[model samples]
Target: MEFVMETKNINKYFHKPKEFHVLKNISFGVKKGEFTSIMGKSGSGKSTLLYILSTMDTDYTGQLYLNNDLVTGKSQRELSRIRNKNIGFVFQFHYLLSEFSVLENVMLPAKKLGEKSPAEIERNAQQKLDMLHIGHLAHQRASRISGGEKQRVAIARALINDPTILMGDEPTGNLDSQNSENVFNIFKKLKEEQGLSLLVVTHDEDFAKRTDRIVQLEDGEIIAQ
Candidate 1:
């Protein structure tokens, strides 16, 4: 089956740190509409692998594919366009602009894409916020909301582009247990209700267990899947 995202013989190195090999022969696939998680302890290359997969770090050896199209060796401009059009990202921190309203934050990606008119983008952004149960907070300043609400707004922003896959790097690391569960449920809802593919890097064992599959990494190598 064609994967939403795939990597082959992927390897990465850190030059300034005395030529340290950060990732080793990593190969994996995230199927369409599948929910997958990557788990490892600190320094295990979990985040490193994620950055490579996300097309944000191109200094690696291997082939990367998104939506069954090879992305390896693409120019930076092409990769940037591909990333913006095909991938939605959420990080451990909700990096929303504090001064922007939640709606504006959610509309930013769609605006950058420039595929839809401003009015249409705003409508779509509001729809995403409503789907995440945060529509009521759309006009609120991002800085004024609770942490949980802000994270939800971040998720809404990620979904605004209607990406091929949603990727997260320890997306719930900053949340309390309840909020973490809420985020997990939101991911689950996206997968079940919208058939959205998701791949997230997380240290939480419980979170990994709940995903359809877990890719376990150790010492820069994929040890299990």
Candidate 2:
């Protein structure tokens, strides 16, 4: 029953042309080692909710907790450090550095954290790639990889820091069915074998249904969980 992440009375607003309420008092939690999916129609604030949970968006009103630590109202510098150490992100786009080798791309996050020696980071990066079955492409330029391979590389990069939770924003949206299934299998393996907590925002019904739980959002509020 331990929660890895939790949000209490979360509310968000967007002030552009006019002020509009986006997220409405969302109270949610993701348990440790739980694989949860957030699903809804476009503009349901699913992505917005993910941003808040990921600690990338602080303009909301809520109490956010990570690893049982209160993270709300923390300074940006502290939040950044927490995110790098505890949250892994995989977006719809791979976002790999085209010019960098696959190994380098995977190693970039650990290098930024500067918690490990370069030699150790390299070895860890290679192990991540190998775990994903992409170690053979370690020396290849990221631009040379196929779309599916690029996504796998992105997953490897997200895992380099040993994050407490892995969050994905439509991770398989750009992939074909086969590759999408491959990514899901990888996620399942990560959860089953490594006990990694995961929260993903996705429009794919099949993908959402396959997860351990699904939180359904509608009109900026969670309608079902």
RMSD of 1: 0.7
Q: lDDT tens string, model 2, 68-179?
A: 9999999999999999999999999999999999999999999999999999999999999999999999999999999999999999999999999999999999999999
Top of the candidates by lDDT: 2
Residue by residue across 12-109, what tens digits does model 1's lDDT show? 99999499999999999999889999999999999888898989999999999999899999999999889998999999999999999999999999
In model 2, the clashing pairs are none
Model 2 regions more than 4 Å off: none
At residue 169, candidate 2 shows an lDDT of 99
Q: Name model 1 segments beyond 4 Å from true.
A: none
Per-residue lDDT for 170 in model 2?
A: 98
TM-score quality measure for candidate 2: 0.99
